[model samples]
Target: MGTLKAWMDYLNSINGKEHDSFFKPYKEGKWSKAAIISHMMFWDRFFYEERLPHMLKGETLVGITAEQVEEMNKKAEEYAHSGITLQEIIDEALKYRQMLLDKLQDEDLSRTFTIKDRKISLQEYVNGEIEHDEHHLKQLKAK
Candidate 1:
C-alpha cells in the first residue's frame, strides 16, 4: 500500500482534458502517460486474473516470458489510445489492484516464485511492483 495514496491523489487531481491529453504519444517513441497508466492497469489485471488465483491456492507459477511481456505492453498501449475514457481504465486498474492487495493481506508473504532463475518472495515481488508504480508516477508528473 505504500505510495498508493500518492497515485490516487494524482489521479484525482487531474481533469478530463488532462486525462485525455495523456493519450498523446511522447517524442522518440516513448510511451505516453495514458499508456503508462494502462500498462499498470494491464499488469494489475493480469495478476488478478492470471497470477493471483494460482498464487492464493499455493500454486507455483512460471514467470512470464519477455515476448509475452512485450505483447501485453503493446496491447495496453493500444487500448490507451483506442478512444476509451481514461476514467474507465483507471477505475478498472484500481478495482483489480484493490482486489489483489486485499486477497494477499492474509496470505503468506514468504511464498516464493522463481523468476529468471532466482527465487523471490511475494513481498519482494510486491515491492518491485510498488517501485514500478513510483517510477511511472514520476514520469506522469513530469509531463
Candidate 2:
C-alpha cells in the first residue's frame, strides 16, 4: 500500500496548482488529465461504497459489465467537463481513497471473492488498482 499512499500524497501536492495542462487532453481523442482523475475518483467511490461493504461481509462480489463500465467512464468524463473544478475532483477522490484505506486496515488481504466467475483476493484487487493508478500517472506526466 506504499504506492497507494504515495499516490495520495501526490494528489494532495497538486490539488490547486492551476496548471493548464491538467485540463487538456494528452492526445487527440484521449481523456484530459482532469477527466482521468475524475474517472479514478468515480471508481474509488464505487469500490468504497458499492463493493467494499459486500466484500467485507464475505459476499460474492457482483461484477460490472463492459457496457456499464463504458457508461460509467462516459459519465465520469462528462462530469469532468461539467464546470466542476479539478480541486473538487481531487478532494472527492482523496476522501473515498482515505475511506478505502481505513476500511482495509484490519482486513484479511487473503480473503477471496468471486467476481464474474473469477476468484480474486483483496490484495490482488488492490494491487491491480495500484497498477492502474501508476499507468494513469505516467499518462499525466507525459509531455
| Candidate number achieving the greatest TM-score relative to the actual structure | 2
- For model 2, give the 10-residue run with minimal summed lDDT: 1-10
Per-residue lDDT of candidate 2, residues 1-143 (tens digit) = 44667668878888878877777888998999999989988998999889988777767877899999999999999999899888898898889889888999999989888787888888888898899888888887788
Count of steric clashes across candidates, in order: 0, 0
- How much does candidate 1 score in TM-score? 0.83
> What does candidate 1's lDDT look like per residue over 1-143, in tens digits?
56445565566677344454577765457888888888988998887788767665555677888999999999999998898888877777777777776788888978876656677787787787888889888788884
| Model 2 spans with C-alpha error above 4 angstroms | none
Which candidate leads in lDDT?
A: 2
For each candidate, the alpha-carbon lDDT, in order, equals 0.77, 0.85
